[model samples]
Target: MEKERGYNMQIPEIQITKSWRKSISMSFDTQGVLQVRAPKFMLSGQIDNFLLKNSAWIDKNFQKITQRIKNKKKYLLWRELQNLETISDLEQYFKQEAKKYIIPRCNELAQKYWFTHAWIRITSAATRWGSCSSKKTLNFSYRLVMSPVECIDYVIIHELCHLRQMNHSTKFWKEVFSIMPSYKIYENHLKNEGWKYTL
Candidate 1:
């Protein structure tokens, strides 16, 4: 791991790993440290050049991660002040919010759109907002309650559309668009801001 700050921008420590790979790739770890994987025989100069070339991309993502860290700290402080310290406490609260808000909203949309589902289940899923099973069961992440209402509806309608079309084919998106013409804005909102919807 090299700690030298060669790039002009102020970035986190760069850790380089030499491997038997053909290319150089870089990404940030959970702590916002930049991790680079390069070919074993790659020279230091080559790696520096790679970093320089991708400085803008690195800076953008680093700022985003920094904001996320700050937001998480604020959330923790608020939780501590509110005495909601335990994971179970947060989970229970999220589940209650999901059931009270998401379930009824899902039912309303289904009825309005003439969509049917076998059931709805709330989960602790972190990677995805919602999914639809082949048996017409819809599973949503309890974390989704933290997102904006429009994003929440987008996820609900997205999974509901899957109840009609199992795949993300053109027809599936068509169904989603038919119900919510502005679905892409909500989808992009989730893609950009959904990371904050965490415990």
Candidate 2:
């Protein structure tokens, strides 16, 4: 049988099944269903208590899966996904696009910001969009090209600013703000919607 529970005004449907199993177990499945399995003899009060105790965990994992599916759908909608049948095709596309776009854009921003770096290289990193090393060399993900021009410039300026300040402190932010006044808008975009660019 199934029931609904509301937490913080968000109601997540839960399905409960009684089985021969000895203990209560909670799980989430690929179809975005939350399931609670209980011993056939267990009381509903015990089951409700178990779910209540783990509500936070359920909320967190459920949101993660929901967002992941949304992102996958967004990624699939991109025209590039249609032609990309293999991993190598995706890699080659990123490399070529990075060379054509990311490198030249970084060069332009570095000049505008009066920043100097040893060099910049493009990568295929899935998580980190960019990084700067102690040696002043900058590495950026090819996926960055998939972002808006504002977001792309934000990432570049962020890494170049690291050339002066290695850590994310007030001084580092001052450097970034000096270049892009509205960077937070693009930064938030990267945090919220940037997952659409992933393969």
Candidate 3:
């Protein structure tokens, strides 16, 4: 069964779904709507108490989602993408730009740093900027083009360093620092602003 209930001013409405599940779980939807899943036999009062107990967690996550939505609205690339008629067009544009910029830049950095890799691949990953496989193949998100050039170089260097140190051990950081002394600045920039890189 499913029903919507008003919780409080901060949370507004919560969509509750009851099923044969033995435990209760909660999460926020893409639109920032709170969703609760509870055992079918649980009472509404019990659910209310559960929500009250977790109000702090709800408030914190809700604020994060709200801020992410606001930032996306203000994102320059996201705004520019509004002119595209379809998601496919937007993805194609990202691929074209990533190939044009990232591939050449990666090659230039690899030569400058004396790093060699098997191959590089661009993907549509949303959760991470780049990855290096055990096979020496490097994978980067096409969304990385949305970042500043320095941030793009940081990611490239990071992945190239991975060819030497696959793990993020102290030695890996040393390799990174050797190439880009100010890598932390670009790292933090991506951490703070990477959310805006999504489609």
Candidate 4:
């Protein structure tokens, strides 16, 4: 059943939790659920008044929060359906995907951008999508295969640029932009959707 709070003004969906704290507070969780934490001793009217006072702000952010929650639930269901049960399953899946798609694409981009590297290694790292060592060796995440080709290309170009400038100085970004004019678009895509590839 859906939990709701009643107030003088019609506020969006919210879940209220009673706490021992002295004051009332509110926030949107990562899943975009609006949560209100109120003093356990506070009266219902006081809470309603507080909600009324902040109704405008709530209304302003309501649509965005609800949409975020919907998108999160949708992705959760999609990921669950994949049945990726073990680390080895995820690793093997991504490794084969990297060999089939990432390696060939990397070769194509390297040729197009005239970049060189010592070696390429596909990894099961969760923290980073890719990295370039000072030794010119390249490391990539196998899960990257789940992202769009544009994001994959961005990661490739991003690391390949490191062949010239190892650090993320203006020169490094300049190298990335030279090959991918709209790199930020794909960059943001990876940031928003990359976690969906996880096991």
| Best model per TM-score | 4
- How far does residue 140 in candidate 2 sit from its true spot (Å)? 0.4
lDDT of each: 0.90, 0.85, 0.88, 0.83
Instruction: Give me the runs in candidate 3 sitting further than 4 Å from their true place.
Output: 1-9, 18-23, 38-43, 85-88, 116-120, 123-128, 131-138, 188-196
The Cα RMSD of model 2 versus the native structure comes to 5.4
**Of models 2 and 3, which has the larger TM-score?**
2
| Tens-digit per-residue lDDT, 1-199, candidate 2 | 6556564544457899999998899888765678889999999898889988998999898887787776666677665456665556776786888889988888888887788998889988889889999999999998988788889889999999999999999999988998889999999999988877776
Flag regions of model 4 displaced more than 4 Å.
1-11, 29-32, 73-91
Using alpha carbons, what is the TM-score of model 4?
A: 0.77
The reply for model 1, stretches above 4 Å from the true place, is 1-61, 74-88
- lDDT, residue 66, candidate 4: 68
**Local error of candidate 4 at residue 146 (angstroms):** 1.3
Give the lDDT of residue 139 in candidate 1. Answer: 94
TM-score of 3: 0.72
Q: Write the per-residue lDDT of candidate 1 for residues 1-199, one digit (tens) a residue.
A: 9776856666678899999999999999888899999999999999999999998899899988878788778767876786777556788898988989999999999999999998999999989999999999999999899888999999999999998899999999999999999999999988877877787
lDDT of 3 by residue, 51-114 (tens): 9999989988998887776777677555656665455677889888898999999999899889
Candidate 2: where is the Cα deviation over 4 Å? 1-30, 37-45, 48-68, 80-88
